[model samples]
Target: MQTQPISTIAFTVFLLLFSPPRAAAVRPPPNPLRSSCAQARYPVLCFQTLSNFSNPTAKPLDLAQAAVRASLVRTRALSAYLGTLKAASQGFGPRQRIAVSDCVQQISDSVSELSKTLNELQHLRDGTFQWQMSNVQTWTSTALTNGDTCISGFNAAATTGNVKLELKQRVTDVAMLTSNALYLINRLADSVTGKSRSNSGN
Candidate 1:
């Protein structure tokens, strides 16, 4: 067999050792929100609502925060819409007016609860993980209840008007969003606590 010259062999070895590493195949980061939301009840809505607030590499806590923020926006919008309906209550009959008033109050309560949930989520590091997670879960649950109460007020009253139906429809959507957010928050809480336990074990 013919042997390569020493200089040629040495140059080839040098190139092999120093040529810029083939850039490791740059993989796009996995979309964390999309993956998590895929398991949500309203997968499409959850993903669409949250994708605007997160990047592909967001962690569970980040995705949970995004979900809370989205729910807050929906609650605030519902509150404002209810306020408008309340303002035009002059045209409503006594029963309809009562329903509108109740809806306005309930929606306002939902806004408050959602706000609290967001605050709790932001301050998760202020307390024990379980305690903070419990507060977030409670507040989100209350917000969902408030949305249901707003819709139920219309249902209980003998109001067959379009306003009642419209308000119910709108609040229903908010309730669904709240429910989805709560699910994400629960998942995040569990994941965070699990990681803490695992690290402590190590």
Candidate 2:
């Protein structure tokens, strides 16, 4: 057998013992927005509406707040548009004018409900978490109901023409946004309840 150099052998052993092990594989962090929207009733719409929302912390409450705020803004805009229709009343029949007036009121109520929801979410506290979440859910649902009422008023009035179509479209859009917001708010409530149960060993 050929003899190997002792120095070379020792150097090889040193390299084996001292070389850094291969770095462990790194994994990307979970996407908060995607995860939040995954279980929503309107996941795609929820994601799109909140895609531009600023949520660096990625907290559930932040997402809920954003959703409610978006609904509130849309409701306010729709209410304003409805007011114009009610005021002009030029082309509208008497029934349509009444429907537009009713819708304006309904949308105004929706705006208030959404505003309340947003406020509750913003001020949510651990001590009153359940109570606050209940209020948020109720208010959000009320807003959605108000939107439905607006549409129903138009239907009952037998409203026709562009005004009817335009009001229905805008109200429907607000209702969808409000519905998504309510869904997210309920999800947040569930998450909180689960955490509470876990902490108490229930």
lDDT of 2 by residue, 11-68 (tens): 9999999999999999989767877888877888888878876464667778888888
lDDT of 2 at 186: 86
For each candidate in turn, the TM-score is 0.80, 0.82
Error of 2 at 134 (Å): 1.2
Error of 1 at 123 (Å): 1.9
Best by TM-score: 2
Worst 10 residues of 2 by lDDT: 52-61
Which stretches in model 1 have alpha-carbon errors above 4 Å? 1-30, 200-202
lDDT of 1 by residue, 1-202 (tens): 9999999999999999999987788888767677899888899898998888777778888888888888888788888988898898898788778888887888788788888888877777735778878888998999889877767777777778687678877888888788889999989988878888899999
Judged by whole-model lDDT over C-alpha atoms, candidate 1 comes out at 0.83
Query: Runs in model 2 with CA error above 4 Å?
Result: 1-30
